[model samples]
Target: MYLKIDERIFRELFHTYYDRLYTGFYKKTGSYEQAQDLTQQTFIKFWRYRDSYNPELSVEIQLFRKGKLVFIDWLRKESKERQMIDSLQQQEKIPVEELSADLKDSLNQAIDQLSPMRKEVFNLAYIEGYSHKEIAEKLNVSVRTVETHVYKSVQQLRKILALIFIMLHL
Candidate 1:
C-alpha cells in the first residue's frame, strides 16, 4: 500500500532532520540522553499534529520551535521541584543527622504505618526523586492517582509524627 502524504512527509522529515535537531538539543541541554528524548518528543509532536502543518512555512523551523517549547517546559518542572525541596528545608532548620535517635525511630515508624502502595509512592517521590508522571508510569497508574497517593501519605505521616511527639513528651 502507498503511504499517505502526511506519513511520507514525516518519514522524510525524520530522516533528514533528526540528527540536526538532536545536535542542537544536546548543545542546549548538555546531556546526550535528554537531547535524544527531546528530539524524539519533537518528532512525536510533529507526527501527532501533522494536519496543522503549513506548507507555506518551513517545517524545519516548526520542529525547532516545538523542541524549544519542550525544553522550556522541562526547565519549569525542574524549577518547581527545586522550590518545593528548598521550602521543606526552610521549614525544618535541623539537619537530619542532628535529629535524635528517638526522633529518627519515630519517623521510620510513621512511614512504616502507611499502606504498602502509599509507602511505595512516598519513597519514590521523596527518596527516589521521581516525578508524579514518572511514578505513575512506573506503577502503571494514572498521574492523578499517583498525586492523590502522595498527598494522602504526607498527611498521614504528619499526623502520625505529631501524635508520636506528643506521647513522647508526656
Candidate 2:
C-alpha cells in the first residue's frame, strides 16, 4: 500500500499538529518559551521527514511521540545546566587562595559520599585553607583526626573524579 502526500496535505497536517504539540509540551514542562521552542522544532522534524510519512503508523501518534522526546531532551539539558551553574556558584564562594578547578569539581562529586564529620573537616582544611589544628578546633576533634580525614578525602575525591574523566573522554 502507498500514500502520496501533497504540499496542501502537508500544510494541513502541520497546522493540526502545531497547536497540539505546543500544548503537550506546555503541560509537561509548564514553560511557554520551552513549549514554543519545541513546537517549532517539531515542525522542522516534520519537514525533514515528510517523504517518509507512513499512513499505517498513524501520523498523529508519530508526531506526538517525537514531540514528547524533544521536550524531554530539553528538560534534561536545562537540568544539567542548572547543576553546572550551582557548582560554579559554590566554587566561587570558596576563597581563591585554596581553589583548584580540577579539585573543586572532584570535591563536588565526592563530598556527598563522605561522612558528615569528615566532610566538615575536609572542607575547612582544604577549601578554607585551615590548618589541621584549626580544623580540629573548629570541629572539636583532635588535630591528628582532622589530618587523616583530609588525606583520605583527597585520595577518594581524586579517584572518583578520575573515573568521571575517563567516562567523559570515552
Candidate 3:
C-alpha cells in the first residue's frame, strides 16, 4: 500500500532523522552545536519543501537526500565567505591589530586551533595568495568545499576570539 504523509508524518520524520542527520553533519563539520543547527535546518527544509514529495519513493530517502544537500550547500557558502574574510584580515586594513598584543595573540591562538585542512586553506588563500582553484587542486577537494570550510572557519575564529577577549578583560 502507498503511504500518505501529512504534517504529522513530517513531524515524525523530523524526530526520527534528527540524530542521524546531526551526527552525519557533525562528523563532516566537527561541531556539536553546528550539527544541531543543521539538523534543525534539515527539518526546516523538509517542511518548506514538503510539496516535492513523491509517495512512490521512500519518504526516508527523500528526507535524507534533502538534508545532506542543504548541509553541503550551506558549507559551500560558508567557505566562500571565509576566503573573503581571510583576504580582508590579511591586509590588516583595519586598526584591530593595533588594539593590543594580548588580543592579537588570542586571535592567533584561536586560528591555531583549526584543523590542518582549514589552516592550510586559510594560509594559501590569505598569506600565500593562492587562488581558490589552486587551493582546491592542492587539497584535492572541490573549490566549492574549500570556500565553505573557509567561511565556517573564519566565522568560528571570530566567535572564539570575541569570547577570548571577553574572558581576558574579565
Best by lDDT: 1
Over 1-170, each residue of candidate 3 has an lDDT whose tens digit, in order, gives 43556788887887787888989989988878778888888888878877767878888898888888888898897787766856754654334436577867786798798888888887787557787788999989887678777776777788888889788889
User: Model 1: runs farther than 4 Å from truth?
Assistant: 1-5, 93-170
lDDT preference between candidates 1 and 3, better one = 1
CA lDDT, candidate 3, residue 44: 86
What RMSD does each model have against the real structure? Answer: 10.3, 14.4, 9.6
Best by TM-score: 1
- lDDT string, candidate 1, 55-161, tens digits: 66687887778878888987897577556544553553344567789998998899999999999998887767788899999999977578768767877999999
Show pairs that collide, candidate 1. none
Candidate 2, residue 167: the lDDT equals 78
**Clashing pairs counted in every model:** 0, 0, 6
TM-score of 1: 0.54
Question: lDDT values of the candidates?
Answer: 0.81, 0.72, 0.78
- How many steric clashes does model 1 contain? 0
Off by over 4 Å in 3: 1-4, 94-170
